[model samples]
Target: MESNKSGFEPKNIWIARRKKQLRSAIIDLLNQYHEVPKEWIDEYNNHTIMSGSIIDTIIIIKESSTNCYEVQFGNGKSGSIVYSELDYEFQLFEATSEVEQVILCRNKVGLTKDKSFVQTMIDWLTSIGFIVDVDNGLRQTT
Candidate 1:
């Protein structure tokens, strides 16, 4: 996702350029202090298992050297990535304590963009003791 420094309009979804820069910086910070890996999986059958499963296209970052984070992106509406022989919906479902943050990103053009979805996702993250926020920038959340 991409956005400009002027901030996104009510009709845009991609990460604003400024937000993207902040996210990259946060990722870099996490990498500097912990093992930051993307798209990891168990070795058994190469199943795409990260922290937990949410839905058909969302995967929660529940397991990592740093902490827990639910990084949601892509939609089953499009050609969403799939994993596991069981064919589980790959959404970030698990609200684990190990996760400290939740990062959600989407194309912004095709998603529901409903605050309910975002709030629900945030509720889930906060319920499990994690800092939750849209991946607009690296603003810390309690």
Candidate 2:
């Protein structure tokens, strides 16, 4: 066989920077407009969407004094919780997708699944924040 001149190697790109910018943008949107429940911040910070996947968006929330959370959106048509096969409580998928529509050659109207997953997640975390711990007084979800 002929001697190879150079080994196969992948090219480097500025994907991380772009992702960081996107993350910052989403965070700003949530922080400025979305009423994110504080309890979900930690979980949101600790979670991230798989790179190279068709992720719609990601948000970072501050759950507690020392915790941050990450909320990711996916390409699905609606919100669907994906559970782990091994552990029922272990969430594997929390992302949601925007909706689309088809016309019938006439006047048509449509609506996408209102980012309900995000609101629901915030609600759940907010509710969890009110839980009382027998040993540690009241504790947040983080």
The backbone clash count of each candidate, in order, is: 19, 9
- The 10-residue segment with the lowest total lDDT in model 1: 40-49
Kindly list the per-residue Cα lDDT of model 1 for residues 1-142, writing each as its tens digit: 7766787464322323433444355345443433323322111112212213332223332323222243543222111111222432223332224543232322111223453333444444444433222443322221
Ten contiguous residues with the weakest lDDT in model 2: 130-139
lDDT of 2 by residue, 1-142 (tens): 7654687332323445554554555455454544344444333332334344344433333222221223333322222222222342213234333442222112112212663333434334333331111111112321
RMSD of 2: 16.6
Q: Pick the candidate with the highest lDDT.
A: 2
Index of the highest-TM-score prediction? 2
My TM-score estimates for the predictions, one after another, are 0.21, 0.28
